[model samples]
Target: PETVTAFQLQKQGSEGSSGERALGQQEGYRVDESGKVYLPFIGEVQAAGKTVMELRQEISMKLIAFFPDATVQVRFLNFRVTLIGEVARPNAYIIPNEQLNILEAIGMAGDFTPYARRNSVMVMRERNHQREFVRVNTQDTTLFKSPVFYLKPNDIVYVEPLKAKQYATQGDFLSRYSPIFFPLVTLATFVLGLSVR
Candidate 1:
């Protein structure tokens, strides 16, 4: 999945006379275009369609063939989210951690602009090959409990612009109507000049 770009795999260390030193041989793996992760002994393992738990289990099973007491942990790395429209800085940001909320995501984008509609923020997400859209109201206290409060990897957050922005940019009456009436005014001026001559 595009959302899952990289992950880390850790193998638990065995207890010794001085006790275990936490994890052993922690390695970072990147998912290739074909959605496969290449490990030392396991070769290429398909990681695209599998969940975190499934991938961890598969890796553990494979590692056990080499080490009788293999304990494996898999976690996503390089979490990212995109923000667009009516924000101070609209761009894709790489989050350092997995847990991210709407407020934090907005903050990462440098907050909303003055013309932003805080009550009409939208989130676009893709899961299991299906796209889902959700609206969030940053002005409401109840937003804390919303399902979209916590953003997922590759999720897009869009802040809508207020009608005031549109009205302000519409320009004055003359500029707006000149395009339609300028031709008629020119034609009439030519006709009047001919009549007077």
Candidate 2:
């Protein structure tokens, strides 16, 4: 129960099954870049800036105005988010529902690696041709409340690794540091012991 409550902030995504979906846009029609989508009997519908659920209701209302016996559904087909950086897999994933959020987006990208800088991740969003950035820390419990937590179409997530990534030769770097740090600490302790004695 607690796990789900924690996950609920971003649980719109289900574990992806391997298969290709049949192509159709019956949920709700999308307005193009020109902001217009054709509904079955509702003519052209404008759907930009509205959530999937909102769009569905709007289309349903329009359909009902004419035919009370008609049933209609609306959803997004091309809506997607892109993830990059220290994740195990970097890719774009389509959102299956209007409820899809940032965690779902990350899950679609195959999750993060051990090296991922959980505190250094950033999200980029575009609205009205202008871009905005939101920083997120996966280590924090309140991350779900962040504006980036709720994704928009075409959002980009970037996960940076710790500065340790800069040390391409880790063994070499460790060897150099260990040799210096080990003796330095030991010598300091030894000197303190002698003075106390």
Which numbered prediction scores highest in lDDT against the true structure? 1
Put down candidate 2 lDDT per residue, 1-197, tens digits, no spaces.
65334223222333335332222232333467777786544677777777667877887788777668765566566566778898877876666665667777677677887778889889998877889988999779889788888887678899988777767568678787998988999999999999999
The per-prediction tally of clashing pairs is 0, 6
| Pairs of residues at least 3 apart in sequence or in different chains that clash in candidate 2 | 27-73, 27-74, 27-75, 28-74, 28-75, 31-36
| Alpha-carbon local distance difference test for all models | 0.79, 0.71
TM-score for all models, in order of appearance? 0.63, 0.67
Model 1 regions lying over 4 Å from their true place: 1-27, 33-36, 44-73, 172-197
Quality of model 1 by C-alpha lDDT: 0.79
